[model samples]
Structure formats: C-alpha cells, structure tokens
Target: MALKPKDIALRAASALVLAPAAVLAIWAGGFWFTGLIVLGGIMLALEWARMSEPQDWRAVGMAVAAGVIAPVIAAHIGQMSLAFVLLVFGAAIAGLVSNRRGGEGLDGAYGVLYLGWPCILLVWMRDLNADQGLYWTVLVFAVAWAADILAYLVGSAVGGPKLWPRFSPNKTWSGFIGGLLAGMIAGGVMAAWLDMGALTAFWGAVLGLLAALATMGGDLWESALKRRFGVKDAGNLIPGHGGLLDRVDGLMFAVIVVAIGRLIVLMIGGNA
Candidate 1:
C-alpha cells in the first residue's frame, strides 16, 4: 500500500531526529561513531534473536555479545582480519549455544554474521585513513539515504508495476531507477566535494549504483525473512521505520560491500 499522510509525517519526524544525530556522531568519529555502530548492531541482534527465537536468552546474549565485541575490538586494535576471525568465532559460539537452547545453530550463527561483521567492517571503513575515512564513510551514508528516499518518493508518485510483488509489493521499477540515478549522483557529488579527482568520482558513482542494488537486495531479503517468520515489522522501535534493522538494513549490506571493495583496494596497493 502507498504511504498514508500519517506515515509520511512520522517518517519525516523520525528522520529529522535521527539524521542529525547520526551526522553529528559520524562527524565526531572515533568512539562516538563506533559506539553508535555497536549499539545499533546490538539492537539488531536483540531484535533478530527475539524475532527468530523469542525468550531464548542464550541466543540473544550470544548475538548481542558478538555484535558489540567485533566493532570494539576492530576499532581499538585496528585489525580487520582479527576482527573477522573473532566475528566468525562468535557466530560459531552462538550457533553451538543456540542448539542447546532448542534452536538450530543456523539461526544464532546467521544472526551474528548478519549483524556483527557489517558493524565491524563499516567502522573499519570509517577508520581506514585519517583523511579519507570520513569521506568514504559519509559517501556510504549519503548514497544509501539518497537511494532509500528517492525510491520511496518515486515509487509512491509514479505507481508503476511492482519490482517484486512477492517480496515487496510496494516496490516498483520506476522507484528503482529513480533511486539508482539519485544515489549515483549523490556518490559522484560526494566524491567531487572531497576532491577525490574525476576518476575516483566516476568509480564512486559506480559504487553508488552497486550499493543501490545491494540496498534493494537487503530490503527484499529482510522482507523475505519477515514473511518466512510470519512477523509484520521487526519491532516498533522507530516512529515510522519499524525497527533498527528496518532503518539500516540497506546500510548494513552496502557497508559490507563497500568494506570488501576497500579491502580489495588495499590489497592491490591502490587507494581509491
């Protein structure tokens, strides 16, 4: 269904509060930003555990610990590789413990991997280099936000054929195109503003396009999960957005992709 007037108002109100707080935390990078990332991940873990296995303390604790610990360790020690190992170990531990709690290892492990690594990796991206880290981090946020906002607006306005009626009935092709275009533009503009050069700007636009696709994929994946589990919204944490996961589902996916891209760049000894 199209967004009602109340939905729009609530969304706007939530964004007004959240956007500024996020921007400020990001601008004050360090513990401030990492703290927020960890907190968000913990919240996601909690929601995931609750949604998947409500009242399962072992599963919930394991997920939360993994999500919170990964980013903190990565930020302090500057070891993305080690952080990754820890994340894997955490997932394994959660999985093992979950089985004892009458759940398949799959749910707990999946929840940790889903929420933990992304949180760590995004912070790692933001701390890559003192000068470039901020730009890249901001770029990810801007592109993701642009894509989400444009897609919703365009989809509501144009009312075209559904992109994937089974997964997300409200999504449309027009919205996808509009969001992709807007996200790419935002990426390119952010790159240029950061004086990243023309070549880098071009690649930024490409990254934005990929990120937009990832965003849609993430949203659809979450929706599919919700459908499979027979839940309406993740949780009513945000005013308009259903939960913390609902708000950053796209960013979680985009940052993982972006972090992987950054890792590849570093491995190749090319900074982009």
Candidate 2:
C-alpha cells in the first residue's frame, strides 16, 4: 500500500520536530554535540565515498579529519578569524590532493566543501553563546524544514513553472517562490523571538531562501550522481529519503553559504 502524502508528511514533520530537540538536548551536555557532529561527518563521508566512483579512502580520511577537527576548532578556538582561514586552506589542500584520477576528483572537491567545511560554521553557530547558540542551531534547522515543506505542499497544489527542468523535473518555480516566502516567514519569526537584529533578518531571509533553493539543488545534485553511477537512492539509510547525503544536501549548501555570510559579517563588524 503506497503511503498517502499526508501520512508521509505527518511522519516527516514529526521527525523534524523531535529530532532537533533531541539534538539540542544532547548538544547541551559536555562534548555530546561535538561527538555527535563528528560521528555524522564521518557517516556522511562514508556515504559520499560510496556514492562516488572508485571510493576514495583519502577523501574519507579528509572527511574524518574535518569531522573531528572543524567542530573542535569552532568550539574552542580563541581567534576565529585566523582559525577559519586555516580551516579553509586545509580543506582546499585536502580537496586538491584527495584523489588522482576519475571523475571522483570533481566529486571529491565538492564533497569536502559540501560535507565537511560548512559544518564548522554550524558548530560555531551552535556555540555562539550557549543559550543564543542553541536557538541559532534550531533556527537554521527549522528554516530549512519550513522551506522544504512549503515547497512540497505548494508545488503539489499549484504546479507552475519548473525550477529546473533538467536537474529536477518535479520541482516547480511556484514551489521555489513558496519556499522563499515560507523561509522569510520562518526566519522573521525566529529573529523576533531571538531578538536578533535587522541584519540577522536579512541573512536569515536571504540565506534561508538560498538554503531552500539549494536544498532542491542538493537533491538533484545527488540524483544526477546516482543516475550516472547507475544506482537507486544514495543509500538505504533513511526511511523515505535516500541517504544522509540526500537528506542533508540542501542544508549542506545553505550552511556553507550562511557560514561564509557569517564570516563576512563578523569581519566587517556586522554582527553588532
């Protein structure tokens, strides 16, 4: 029996609600968040390698190192500016050297950028002020969820212009607009609740929308990879979603952009 859309939606929404609370709770304890994020980074690394051609172990090692180090640096680094420069340099060098042949080079390049680095920003966001950081963590997650759900719902009903006909046939431009609007609303509400500034609203709305758009991009990006690799789904990890990569692709892009945005803001004293 094929599950009804409503049923699938209900389960997804439930999971979204419960999962982050669990994560936030776990993260509050000493080293729990760090440990969990590292574990996720490793798992995501392994999954990405399996998805790519000729599974590069060096890439896997890079992911492992990133998983362990980036979060720790973000959590404890005294000078975030210098530390971030070094982290980016390390990731670039690792991506440059992770693989020798095959299309896996391109895959390896984006995979580290996609999988390993942005997570550092998320960790920094999580540790911004413990109390404040928790909300930031939850906000990013919630914003992504809101955009995805809204896009799906509106996309189904309206079914207007396709966002990208080549990559994702099912995605409609209507869904894109819906996601942007939904993200804006979600970000606004979170900003008000958190007492964040107008600039937070700016990044939140812009980044939130970009996150939603990139979420679709991430979906299609993996879809293209799997199709090229002659596989169905990234892996059998998630129930409905293909794999952790499939689930996180959008958030991955979103966080990276948001992290860069944050870095820029911090550099220019925009946070104040």
Candidate 3:
C-alpha cells in the first residue's frame, strides 16, 4: 500500500532532523558518537523486550540494557576484544534471567546480539583508522540511507511482484533493484570524494552492494519479528518511522557487513 502524503511528509521531516544529528555525531567520533550508540542500543533493547515479553518487559529490558551498555562502554574505551566478550556474557545473563522469569530465553539472548553487536561494531569500526574512520563511517550511513530512500520511492512508484510476500508484502523487486543501485552509487561517490584510487572506488561499490543485500535481509528479518509479535510497528518513537529499531534496522545490518569486510581486508594485508 502506498503511504499517504501526510505519512511521507512526516518521514521526510523526521529524517531532516535526525540525519544531520547522526552525521554530526559520526564526525565528532569520540564521546558524542559513543553516546549516540549507547542511547540507541538502550532504546532498541527496551523495544525488543516490550515486543517479546510485554508482561515481563521491565526485567527483560534491564537485562538487555546491561548487555548492550557494557559492551558499548568497552568498545568506546578501545577494548575491542573485551567488548565482544562482554556482549556474549551480557547476552547469556539476559537469557538466564528471561528463562527464570518464564520468558523466552532464546529471544532474550538473541535480542542482546541483535541490538548490541552492531553498536559495538560501530564504535570499533570508527576507531579502526583514525584518519579514514570518519569517511568510512559516513560512507556506511550514506549507502544505507540512500538505499532505503530509493527503495521506498521506487517501490511505491513502480509496484510490481512482491520481493517476499511472507516477510515483507509491500517490498517489490523494483525497490530492491533500485536500492541496490543507489547503495552502489552512494558508496562509489563517497570513495571518489575521499580521493581514493579507482580500484578503491570499485571496491567501495562492491561493499555497497553487499551492504544493500544485508540491509534488505535486516529489514525482512525485522518484519518477520514484528509479524511474529503481531505488531504493525515496533514503537512510535519517531514521527514517521515506527521506532529507533525500525529506523536503524537496515543500518544495523549494513554496519555489520561493512565492519566485517574491513576486518577481512585488514587481515589479508589489504587497505580497506
């Protein structure tokens, strides 16, 4: 179904406000960026808990909150390895608490990883290369945002066969293609702007394509979660977007892809 003009306006307005703030945080790259990640992670945890176990939402939320916060703090302090370990430990704690309280232990555990890993990775990635970290972070955001915006616009205008009727009935093949192209173009442009070599630009485009695929996967996964919970939106935190989780779902996955890709390049003695 096409969004009403009012809905579109709301989305645009929200993006106008949020995008700049996010970009500014990314540029700041220290306490500001870490703070944003922490806040978003906490909100996501609460939302997940609310959806998964409304009756025991507080307990689950607190558990997930601890899980997300500890790792974020660790990552911010340059303890990447400790951050990963803390994330696992936090998830385990959350799971145990949920199981004892008669909630789904696996759901609670998954929530920590789902909402927390990206936060940790984002911080780690930002600190990976002091010189290029800003550019890389901005590139990830640009690709994800461009892909999402293009997908929505193209999908609504050129509605055709549904991409996945089960998970996301409203998504179309046209939208997916549009988003993919947008991601590639955005990544390439960012690389070129950074004055990287042509080969780097080509690799950037490839990364964008991978991120786009991951973005779609993330969106579909979130849709499946909502479907299982029988909710239309995660929460009404934003004017147009459903919640913090809804807004950052695709970006979260894209971050994971980009971070892993960077790590692989580093391990192989290649410049990322």
TM-score of each candidate structure, all chains considered together = 0.92, 0.75, 0.95
C-alpha lDDT values of all predictions: 0.78, 0.63, 0.87
What order do you get sorting by lDDT, best first?
Answer: 3, 1, 2
Over the stretch 1-272, how does candidate 2's per-residue lDDT look in tens digits? 22258756765875676587556654583366656666677767767666664456545455535643663465545456654665565556545555453334555656555665656666676666655566666667767777777777788778877776665677788877887788777766676677543346666677666666666566667667777776776666766666766667677666665555455555665553
Candidate 1 TM-score, true structure as reference: 0.92
Cα misplacement distance, residue 166 of candidate 2 (Å): 2.0
RMSD of each candidate relative to the true structure: 2.1, 4.2, 1.7
- Best candidate, TM-score-wise? 3
Cα error, residue 214 of model 2, in Å, equals 4.1
Top candidate (lDDT) = 3
Worst 10 residues of 3 by lDDT: 191-200
Candidate 3 structure quality by residue, lDDT tens digits, 163-237: 999978999999999999999998877877774323278888998888988887888899999999888888889
Clashing pairs in 2: 161-173, 215-250
Candidate 1 wrongly placed segments (more than 4 Å): 1-3, 55-62, 197-199, 264-272
Worst 10 residues of 2 by lDDT: 96-105
Q: Which pairs clash in the backbone of model 1?
A: none
Q: Give lDDT: candidate 1, residue 104.
A: 66
